[model samples]
Target chain A: MAKRITLPITDEDIKNLKAGDSVLLSGTILTGRDAAHKRLYELIQNGDSLPVDIKGEIIYYVGPAPAKPGYAVGPAGPTSSYRMDKYAPTLLELGLKGMIGKGARNKEVVESIVKNKCVYFAAIGGAAALIAKSIKSEEMLCYEDLGTEAIRRYTVEDFPCIVAIDSDGNNVYETEPIKYRK
Target chain B: MEIRQIKAETVTETVKKLFMDCNYFIGKDIMTALKKSFENETSPVGKSVLSQIIENDKIAANEEIPLCQDTGMAILFVEYGDKVVIEDGSFEDAVNEGVRQAYCDGYLRKSVVSDPVFDRINTKDNTPAIIHTKIVSGNSIKITAGGKGFGSENMSAIKMITPSYGIEGVKQFILDTVRTAGPNPCPPIVVGVGIGGTFERAAQLAKQATFRSIDSSNTDPRYASLERELLEEINKMGFGPAGLGGNTTALGVNIETSPTHIAGMPVAVNICCHAARHASATI
Candidate 1:
């Protein structure tokens, strides 16, 4: 059974979750992808303040298509998480609570997930149209010049995901495949 | 021989329709493969994921929206008839204009950047599509086009192996690439292996192989068998649907081969995600 949880996930929420637990996330989350992450990393390096608060936020790595009429966002699915591996540790250090994306993370990002008591969720890759239904509203927050790769805030309800890596660093990408491997 | 004068605007309109239709509608071959994989998939999670993908495709088609967000950089494989000539403009410009209109008017995302290494700026309208054109001996132009999302494309690889490396070398390289790709390219991926070509030709053939329908296999019996064997081996990896775990890692393995130099044998593997958006038209 999938656990129903709200966003701005707490450390206790992270602790109780294990790798492979199906989750339905509600409430609000931040969106950023490769270009947005690069800008955020630059700001952190130069000791500049971030445009959006990172504390207790779950960032979704996605660059959604432009919505048609009567839509919040268009066909928004998670991008590959590994692309943001270089920047994820820094965000985790700033008290980011969780991340939603597809694919595996690097060693450093996985370690940071453990250290910072963060969780990594994997939304089904390529399931963009179905996933978009969960996003109820979206507002551009920063990096609008980056276009779809801009940073935005999304209000989501019952967004489906799996805990790919939990706070203790149990990673589904490593363990689950082993079980089913012939 | 009579020249078939094709209006440049005709080409533009055809290309425009192809892009929009390919983005909005998941190919029938892919939809069927997904259904078959869903029934065969052992993992409960994999089954659920496949179900969602199936539903997503149907929704995108009915709602007339893109099946995936990446909508991909535009790619067209054109077989231009030698006896056909465009009336008003160059074939290239007409095709780019088509891509521009489809992406902008159809609401597809424009993912192309002005440069790769530095100053990567979005092309905005998704113009300057990557087009591969061949002059053939016919009066009509045949175009096979697809919107190639990069999640799986980034996992593609190519290598130059000697003739001494033989068939075993080819198999090993294909398997290694898929293993390395694992879940990253999105599971139930379509693996396109191009063998026995020069470096760049191999890569192009690999990309072309991806545009081939998953319902089909290579023409040669030996290559077709190899395709089946590779698909089996890949499924054994258990990356499954969404790569969480299961029985079906790849929906299909397509091998397209060409005769090569005596000493050099190059192989390229182009992995494509399940969306596999491709459409064809003859004009």
Candidate 2:
């Protein structure tokens, strides 16, 4: 039987996650990407006020297209997570419960994810339009001038994602490929 | 010279429209290659992956959605026909306007930053597209739109020298790049190789190579053979979709060659994921 989940995820709940676990995420997710992440790290390093409280929230590594009339955003989907690995440990320490992206992460980020009891989730990499459907609404939280890189709060519904790396430091890219590899 | 000026705003909107259209429409060449991927995928897992990709493309096109999440850095190749002139707006500004509208109105991600080393700030509109302009003897402008997924973009590189190395050296370089790329560029990639140009030109040709239809063959028989050989070797590495493992890794290989100085042999490989998004327009 598959595990059913609700929001307000805690570190403890995150620790229970394993690769291939199908998760239904709700609540608030903050959107960021390479540029946004670098700026966020700079703020944290400089002790500046962050746009949102980072504790126990999921952060999506994405930059979406402009929304059509009556739409919140366009073709929103995850980017490569590894590019942001440099700053991930700090976010993990800041109480981030989950990270969203496609593709694999480095060893250090994987270790940090495990240590922080955070889950690295992968939304379908290229299904931007499909993923866009999950975002019920979006509100710019910070860096509004940054446009797509702006830290926006999104309300997503049944956003389908796979657990690529679990809290135990198990990596789907490394281990799973070995089995299916000829 | 016939001179005509286009309103900057209109040019901008056109680029945006192309961005949206490219994601929704998979050209015949690409469609054919993807279908072959479905038929030739030896592993059940790989075949299933290919089918899902096909299904995803259909859903994206039918739903007018993006084929992949990394709605890449918008790259434009502009060919300025000799007799035509764009009025009011500079060529660069016109291109940027198109990028902004595509990213903003069409809801494509704006992936570019103002700077790379410091102050990595998103330009917001995915503007300042990586534009390569050429002057040709015609009275119209043509733009090629390409949205590269990040997984493949990160693996692109340029190398210098090693001519004494010849084809064997080139082959080794390709293998090395793939081995190092691992799961990063997304397996089942279409690799674009550029031979014989200045370093940057080689890079440009490599990227240009990706915009060619997947099923098209290199007119040069030598280049075509190189393409086939490289594709075979890459698959032997056992990197499957998302690097999950399978017998098939790459769907195709493309090489764009240019004449270069005898002293220089610059090579570049620009990688493109299966969700290769590109479209063409004339204005």
Candidate 3:
């Protein structure tokens, strides 16, 4: 059975989750991808004020297609999470509670997830159209020039995901595949 | 030989329709393979993910939207007939214009950047598609088009192996590449291997192999058997659907080959995600 949870996930929420557990997330989350992450990292390095608050926020790594009429977003599946590995640890250190993306994280990011009590969720990659249905509304947050890669705020309802990496550093990407290997 | 005059507008319209249709509709071969994988998948997580993917495809087709957000860089493999003459505009321009129309008017995401390293600005309409054209003997044009999302594209690899490396060398390289790609390329991935060509030709053949239908096999029997064997080995890796874990790591393995120099045997592996959007047209 999938666990239902809301956004602004707390340390207690992270603690209870385990690798490979299915989850359905609701409430609000922020969206960012490769380009957006680069900018955010730069802002952190320079100690500049961020356009959006990171404390207690969950970030979804995605660059959704433009929505057609009567749709909130278009094909909004997660992008490859590893591409943001360089910047993920920094964000996690800043109180970002969770991340929703596909694929594995590097060693540093995994260590940071443990240290910061953060969780990493994997939304089904290439399941964009279905995932988009969970996003009820979207508003551009910043970096509009990046087009689809821009940062945005999304209100989600029952967004499906799996806890790929739990706060204790248990990682599905590392452990689950071993069970099925022939 | 009579020249068949094809209007530029016809080319534009055809390309536009191809891009839009390919994005909206998941290929029948891929759908069938996914269904088979779903039935065969053992892991509960893998089964659920496959089910969601199948559902996503249906919704995209019925609603006329893209199957994935990364609608991909436009790639066209053109079999141009020597006796056919494109009127009013060059074939390249027509194709790009078609891409522009489909991306802008069809509401597809414009993912193309104007440059790679410098001034990485979005071209906005996904114009200037990557086109591979070959002049053939017939009087008609056959086009195989695919929107190649980079998630899997980034996992592709090419290598130069000597003839001494032999068949075993080829198999090892392909498997190694897939292993390295792991969960990143969005399994169950389609593995496209190109053997016995020059470095670049090998890469091109690998990409073309990906555009081939998953249900189809290589014409040569030995290569066909190689495809089957590789598929089995890859499935054993347990990458499964969305790479969480399962028995069906790869939905299909395709091998395309060409005769090469006695001294060199180059191979390339092109990985395509489960969506595997491709379509073909003849004119």
Candidate 4:
């Protein structure tokens, strides 16, 4: 059975996350993919204020499709998180609590995550339809100009995801594949 | 033969409809690949991911939703029957018309960029669909299209004059590409390998071959055998779903080959993650 965890997720809680554990992330998570991160990192460089207070907040690396008129957001899912590796260490330094996306991360970023008491989660890629059910509501926080790459705030209801990378530097991607490799 | 120059407006309208339907329908070949993957996946996590992909397809179909968020840059393979003539205007224009309407009506995100390097501007309309036109024998036009996203496209590669690296060389190249690709391309990817042809042609073939049904085998026995072997090897890498580590790094391996210069073993590998977005129409 896949174990589920609620959000405002603690380091200890995320540290315990294994590859197979099914996590239900419920909290005030932020959405930012490549473009927003570029801007956020620029803000860091310029010492500017972020559109949202990211301290202790989780960020989902996603570029959601355009939502229908009445919907909170469109088919929202995580984009590959590694593209932000160069900027990730900077974000981690700013009290970035968690990241939800798929795929692996660089070793340096992984170390920063461990050093900064951060976490990384994975919502099933390509399960956009099923994943959309987790969002109870959403608010466009900033970067409305970036289309799907815009920054937004989300309220999730037992949003399902998995912890792919944890603080101990025990990456599920590295360890799990070893077990399965013939 | 009915001489009908379909209005650019009409062609455009029909293409958009094709986009909407393709996103929801998981093709037969992809289905076969999933089944095979589910059966052979060694890692529990890998099996689970494949299952999720399968379930996602079902959910999209039943719920009438797009299968993946990256609905892709709409690409069209238009086969105009030699007898059928479009009277209204340019075939390309009609095709783009279709893409614009489909994307707009379906509420799919406009992901295309007019400029690749600097501007990175979203074209908003997802306009100027990539159309590859080929004329065939019949009267009706046959359209096959897919929404291709960045993750897998980023993983695509073309190599010219790679020497007789033989089977091992090819295997290493494929693995190396995946390793270098890391998580960007999206793991548990479907790799379409196109061997032979000029560099550009190889890459194009690789992309075109992606539309091939997943379970279909190459007519060449050697290539067929290699495809199976590569599939097993890729799974052994244990790249699992989203590279969180698992037995299923890839779902299947497909190879398309054509005669080429004796000295040049030009090859291309195009990666399509599990969200294999594709649909076809016979109009």
Candidate 5:
């Protein structure tokens, strides 16, 4: 059975995770992508007040479609996280606890994950409709001008993901290919 | 000489429907490939991931939602018949109108930014599609339209190899690109390899190759063998589904080649995600 995890995860929770562990995450998480990360990184560099709090929160890298009449948001799937690598370490230092996205991260970002006692989880990259079912509620936080790249808060339930990088900095994206290659 | 007059509105309507339908429906060839991949996948994690992707596609089809969030940039390939004439307006305007209607009416995401460099603002309606036109010797206008998501698109590559590099070099380059891409382009992916032609022609052929049915092979026996070999090699690398690890790394590899200058062998790899949304209409 997959392990179950709750949001605003503690360091203990992060430390227990190792790369390749399937997890079901619940509770609140923030959403951002390339544009939002650039803006947030700029704000930090300028030493200006951030629009949203990052302390002990997870940020999902996604840009979803516009919601239909009844849905909270449209199909919300994880985008590639490597584009955010340049800004990730800064966010980690500011108390960001976890990140949910897909694909590999660079060396610096992985090191920051270990140093910050944080975890990186990967949702299925192409499984947008399936993933969107987990999002129970969503509200815009800031950077609405960025359109779908805008920052928002999402309340998810049992959001499925795999631990791509753990606090020990063991990265599944690195080790898995070696083990599975024919 | 007989001229077949086709109203611009008819072209617009056809294109709009094609884009909308392609986004909602997974092509039969892709669906078949996914099922086969699921059956052959050795890893339990890979198998389950494939199942989820299959289920996700079904949900998108039945519920009328998009298969992936990155609805992508509009790309249209127009094969204009020499004998056909648009009665009301210009050919480019008709194609753009179709794209605008499909993106807005179908509720697809508008991902086109106005400029590549300065002022990278969303075009809002996904207008000014990347349309490539070729004049052919028929009376019908054949349009192949699709949305190309950038997640995989960004992973694509191009190289201008000297004739001395040969086929072995071509194979190695493809292998390197897929290996480096790993899990990023949303495996299992459809790889489109464009060989020969000039630099821009190679890139266009690579893009065009992605729209072919995954089950089809190149007409030339030599290139078909190369396609099969590349597909086998890619799957062996074990990027699996979502790169979590497994044998089903790539679904298909389509190669399209044209005669090129004796001095240069331009090659381009255009990677399309499994969603590979595309539909064609001849009217």
Candidate 6:
């Protein structure tokens, strides 16, 4: 059975998680991608207060499709995490505890994951429809001008993911491929 | 000289329907390949992930929703007959009209930005498609419309190398590109390789290559074998489905080649995700 985790997660919750563990996350998480991350990084550099609180929150790297009538969000899947590598260490320093996205992260981000006692999770890429079903509700948070890239908050139920990089910095992307090679 | 007068409405209507259909429906060839992989994939995680992707496709079709959120920037490859003439609107206008309506009515995401550098504003209707038109010697016009999401598009690369690098160089580059892309392009990708042309032409050929079905092989036997070899090598990399780990990293590697100058050997790798959403219409 997969581990079941609820959001507003703590360093303790994430530190106990290990790479390759299947997880079903339930709780409030924020969504952002390249554009939104850039804006947030700029705000931090300018020493201005962020529009959304970062402490103990998980950020999903996604820009979902527009929802149809009676839907919370449409096809919300994880975008590639490497694009956000530049801003991640800063967010880690600011108390960000978890990240949900697809693909591998850079070396620095993995280091930050270990140092800050956070976790990096991978939701299946291109499995957007399946993932979106877990989002129970969604509300726009900031950067409305960014369209789908806008920051939104989602309350997800049993959102499926794998711990790609755990607090100790074991990375599935790096180690898993080596085991499978002929 | 005979001029084939084609109504602008024909182009607009065909394009609109193609865009919506391609986004919601996974191509039959890709669907079959996914099913085949699901059975063949060895890793338990990889198998389940493949099953989920297939299920997602089914849900998108039954629900009439987009298969993925990135509804993509509209890209059309037009094979226009030299003798054909649009009766009312310009060809470009009709194509854009079709894209505009499909995105708006289909509830697909509007992903195109008006400007790449400054102001980066959303066009709101996925307008101004990236169109590549080739004037041919026939009366009928053929349009291949593809919804290209950027997750995979961002992983594509182009390089200009010396002709002396030859076939071995091309093979090495293709493997290297796929290796670097890893899971970022979404594994089990369709690789479109363009070789032996000018920089722009090679890039165009790579784009055209992605429109080919995953089930089909290159017409030329030499290139066909190369495709098979590359596919085997890529699968061995163990990127698998979703790159968690397995033996099915790439579904197909399609190569399109054109004659080039003596000194130049330009190659482009256009990696497409499993959704490889595209459809065609000829009128």
* Tens digit per residue, CA lDDT, model 5, A52-102: 999999999999988777888898889999999999999999999999999
Q: Which TM-score does chain B of candidate 3 obtain?
A: 0.99
Model 5: DockQ score = 0.82
Candidate 2 DockQ vs. native: 0.42
* Chain A TM value for model 1: 0.98
Top candidate (DockQ): 3
- What local lDDT score does residue A78 receive in model 4, on the 0 to 100 scale? 77
Poorest lDDT segment (10 consecutive residues) of candidate 4 chain B:
B1-10
Off by over 4 Å in 6: none
Of the true interface contacts, each candidate retains a share of 0.73, 0.50, 0.76, 0.69, 0.74, 0.67
Give Cα distance to truth, residue A124, candidate 1, Å.
0.5
lDDT at A51, model 4: 80
Tell me the docking grade of candidate 5.
Answer: high
Give the per-residue lDDT digits (tens) of candidate 6, residues B1-283.
5989999999999999999999999999999999999989999889988999999999999988899888899999999999999999899999999999999988889998888998788988999899999999989999999999999999999999887888899988989999999989988899999997899999999989999998898899999999999999999999899999999898888999999998999999999999999999999
Of 1 and 2, which scores higher on lDDT?
A: 1
Over B140-257, each residue of candidate 1 has an lDDT whose tens digit, in order, gives 9999989999999999999998888889999999999999999999888999988976998999999999999988989999999999999999999988888899888998999999
Worst 10 residues of 6 chain A by lDDT: A6-15
Per-residue alpha-carbon lDDT of candidate 4 for residues B108-177, written as tens digits (9 for 90 to 100):
8788878888998888889878888888877788788989888788878777745677767777777777
Write the number of the candidate with greater TM-score, choosing between 3 and 4: 3
Interface RMSD of 5: 0.8
- Model 1: per-residue lDDT, tens digit, A1-182? 99999877877788999999999999999999999999999999999999999899999999998899888888899999999999999999998889999998999999999998899999999989899999999999999999999999999999999999998999999988888898
CA lDDT, every model vs. true structure: 0.93, 0.77, 0.93, 0.79, 0.92, 0.92
With a 3 Å backbone cut-off (N, CA, C), the pairs that clash in candidate 6 are none
Which pairs of residues clash in candidate 1, taking residues 3 or more apart in a chain or in different chains? none
TM-score for the A chain of candidate 3: 0.98
> B27 in model 5: Cα distance from truth in Å?
0.4
